[model samples]
Target: MDLLKKKILAEGSVEEGNILKVDSFLNHQLDVAFLNEVGKEFKRLFEDREITKILTLETSGIAIASIAAQYFNVPVVFAKKIATKNLDKATYESDVYSYTKGRTYKIKVSKKYITSDDRILIIDDFLANAQAALGLMDIINKAGATLEGIGIVIEKGFQDGGELLRKQGINLKSLVIVDSLEVGNIKFR
Candidate 1:
């Protein structure tokens, strides 16, 4: 995790209101080799659990989840941020507040993907307030599936998302946790 922490300190920018913009290597353009390491770390952290599926949100979470799925040998299912015409009416839906985007949106997942028999591992690029993670967990609940764990690439420890999920007894793992981002300085937890 030191390498990842180092990458964040070097390339990540701290915007006003405690947002860490990792668009260069994560949310926008991706680094495949770095992602592979992330996948391996996730696999290692959750080795004891039986992960049948990898669940994530659309757009940003897709690439990270798909890459990690290769390590888990499980199928990746991403909840769509926008409702599409082809989507079924019987799908599970949840609304999430995105701090980075400065808006609230509904995310949906088809009911056919998750089931009672599956153990799901949620993966995403970042976790600040954890609204998206909670929304995804809600979808998993609606499908009657068990949440195996959550694998976050980067977590803002200064926020409440990680603590909130931990308080709920959900298994959460963050590769690099930012304790503070004050005046362009990155502090790790």
Candidate 2:
């Protein structure tokens, strides 16, 4: 996690609305070596859990979930933000309000991928408002699946997401938590 913290300090930038953009190695561009370390850390964190599948949201969470799935030896199921013809009609859906985007959108997942008997581990790039994770949790509940835990790469601790999830008794693990992003300065928690 020290590596990730260092990378964030080196390349992360703070946008206008307190958004920490980590496009260099995380969200936009792919860094397999760094992501591999992330995967290893996640595996180590959730190794004792009975994880049947890895769940994530599309766009940003896809790569992290996919790489981490290799360690868990489970299929990665990503919730689609955009509705497509390939997606089944019978799907589990949840509404998520994006703090960064400033709007609410529905995220969906096919029922076939998740079942009642499976234990799910949710993975994502960031946790700020906890809306995405809450939306994914709603889908898991609809499928009657058990949520084993949540793995976050970089948690914006200045926000309430991590605290909210922890209050709900969620087993959340974050690699690097940024406690502050004031005036483009990053403070770790």
**Structure candidate 2, residue pairs in collision:** none
Candidate 2, residue 110: lDDT: 94
Backbone clashes for every candidate come to 0, 0
RMSD of 1: 0.9
Candidate 1 global lDDT:
0.92
- Whose lDDT is greatest here? 2
Residue pairs of candidate 1 with colliding backbone atoms? none
lDDT scores for all predictions? 0.92, 0.95
- What does the lDDT come to for candidate 2? 0.95
lDDT of 2 by residue, 14-64 (tens): 888889999999999999999998999999999999999999998899999
Error of 2 at 73 (Å): 0.5
Backbone clash total for model 2 is 0
TM-score of each: 0.97, 0.98
